[model samples]
Target: MTNEPIIPTRKLLLVCGCLLGLTALTVVAYYVDLGVFHTPVALGIAGVKAVLILLYFMQLRYSSGMTRAVIIVGLLWLGLLLAGTMDDALTRGWLNVGAP
Candidate 1:
């Protein structure tokens, strides 16, 4: 037993609780009116859930730094794509003489 660490049962249970709590909150958020930024808020909530999974359930907290960097890169790339698409859609048409 050369100091091989062990995660306690209580901490594991707490993490599980957090996951469930977030899931419930996400459902509630879906039902409520988040006003003008509803979609962005929901997307942010999903990102939070993903981070929780990566940090806890996915055990990334105990993994190497490279793995974490990869996760961050993936998320950033996704954000870039989503932002680019939204930008294109919003700016695709201006005054093109009734270009339907």
Candidate 2:
């Protein structure tokens, strides 16, 4: 049998409350204009929510070392994919091509 750590009901409720608050913040951020900071702010809040879900709901905090390593690797791979896509998009207009 595998041994797993059990979380308390109060902690779970707190996390749930935090997640709800963050969701509300995200919606509020959408209506407010921070110019170039909007996207980063939204993404930052999302990242925090993701971490909370991963650690508590998914039980990654109680998972084995290998499981955590795998999660990290997966995140790294996703980051690389996003970076590549952004690189291509941002550089697309650098060169001008004549209409054929």
| Candidate with maximal TM-score | 2
Q: Per-residue CA lDDT of candidate 1, range 1-100, in tens? A: 5332566778778877887888888889889998987888778877887777777677777777888799889989999999998876776677554533
TM-score of decoy 1: 0.71
- The lDDT for every candidate, in the order shown, is 0.79, 0.92
Instruction: List runs of model 2 lying over 4 Å from the truth.
Output: 95-100
Query: Candidate 1: misplaced stretches above 4 Å?
Result: 1-6, 95-100
TM-scores of all predicted structures: 0.71, 0.84
Candidate 2: clashing pairs of residues: none
The stretch of ten residues in a row with the least summed lDDT in candidate 2 is: 91-100
